[model samples]
Target chain A: MTLLEIMVVGVLGLAGVGMYGLLISRNLIKIVVSLQVLVKGAMLALIAAGYASGHINLAQSMAVTVIVADTVVAVIGLALAIQVRRRFGTLDVKELATLQK
Target chain B: MLNAILVVGAVVGALQAIRAKRLLVSALWLAGCSAMVSILFYAMDAREMAVIELSVGAGLVTVLFVFAISIAGEDTSDVRAFVPKPLAWLLVLISIGLLGWMIIPTIGAPIPGVEPSFSEILWQQRGLDVIVQSGLMFAGIVGLLGLLADAKVPAKETAAQKQAATSIPPPPKALSQSPAIREEAHV
Candidate 1:
């Protein structure tokens, strides 16, 4: 397979794995992890497509923006998750759903 | 050969991360996956992206996950019924297979575009985007500071801390003490 093909397969596989994680995981941290995995797959695809199309700079800049946004989102999400855990006393979604207030 | 290895390694690491029992273990595996992805980006001749992925995805994201896990410390009870495992696996396989099948034919297809230097494209065409992105990052930093601000800093300072705080002269007065005093006084 060509490098592009390999990357495409890798991206798709990573997305699939991330989705599986998202569906099955109960822990909030794991959920975040799964989401990151999914985002990484999308970033990979973006750069790979850019490379193939000969617009490397456009892709790089876009990827940088994405990385920054991703970091911010992750930080904010973790902070929120920590707050949830502190208030609810558990990270499990099932427990969280049943938690009053 | 190296490309295939990196891709497989990344995919395996991601799978392991999703499957690992302990949250910490899962997070570390995610880091490993990110490292592999960075390597793949490097191999694809996107060196800048590789470094960014290494620093942000592997480094910063992992640290954030660890900190969150530490704060949310608890043994998560495994839920067997959250989603049916077999169905999930089947969906994963099918989706991957379908996407791979669709994209493989597009490999090596030539794309037509006005080929400008990457630097020019970044600085000229997308300059505004870069500025906005910088603003976004700054906003993110400010928002995070607000979100994680510790409320326990005490509206009422302890006497010793208050004394320490007051004992320190204002910047203008402190600056005046330098010429040491002269150099300080200018500020």
Candidate 2:
């Protein structure tokens, strides 16, 4: 197996871990953070595939697209975070779930 | 040696982001993961991608996360996490299958023949996709600007906080548990 293959596998593992953390965490901030980690891992896996091919055009372009999408998600998450802070005095996802329930 | 380093760093960073209780520390770890991925990009010869990954992922996004975390405040001990055992096992099996399927086609394909023409495909067949993607990026930037335009810091104090600041105030029954609230008091 090539070094690039290992990297791709490792990145996949990292992405999985990030997703798991995000899924299980109830803290609003941690959920947001886990999401960030998820984005990072996803980007890495995609870009690693591009790199393994030794091609610049597609890989770089893919990274740009991913980053832009992530930025939008991050902004919306922040807005929600602020709203949660003001309305409930806490950002715990558990509390938010309770409130919703 | 280089790929090994990048892989290790990425693994460490991932663990840190998951485990770190402090939001700032999590952000720091997030940056580390971003940096590792950037370096991995370079190793794969996509220099342009490496630069974008570092600059955007580590620099801009990490700062954005830190800012959001600070604004959200911390009295969030009520949060909980639970994962069903059956679901986790299902995830493991699916991921393994995905790995086998994706890795095989990606690597087993002819490199020079299959991939050498990718640039032409990117420009010709995928041209519209690229343009639409760029438009999406522009829309995101504009949305972020709109958010920055309407932000108010809440006058550094709420009514409850002001009452506490002025009069005898409520006892600090939850100072340690509620740093975000204490932040309002100080502000």
- Highest DockQ model number: 1
Regions more than 4 Å wrong, model 2: A52-54, A98-101, B75-78, B84-97, B113-131, B145-187
Candidate 1 residue-wise lDDT, B42-135, digit = tens = 8888898999899989998999888888878855577774879998888878887887787667767558778676678768888898798889
Off by over 4 Å in 1: B112-114, B150-187
Task: Tell me the TM-score of chain B in each candidate.
Answer: 0.70, 0.62
Give a tens-digit lDDT track for model 1, residues A1-101.
Answer: 88887988789978898989888888888888898998889889888888788776678878887888888888887887787777777777778776586
How would you encode candidate 2's per-residue C-alpha lDDT over B5-58 as one tens digit per residue? 778788788778877777788789988988987888777777766887789888
Task: Kindly give the stretch of ten consecutive residues in candidate 2 chain B with the minimal lDDT sum.
Answer: B108-117
At residue A53, give the lDDT of candidate 2: 60
Candidate 2 C-alpha RMSD relative to the actual structure: 16.1
DockQ of candidate model 2: 0.33
- Which model scores highest in lDDT? 1
Each candidate's lDDT (Cα)?
0.84, 0.72
Report DockQ per prediction, comma-separated: 0.57, 0.33
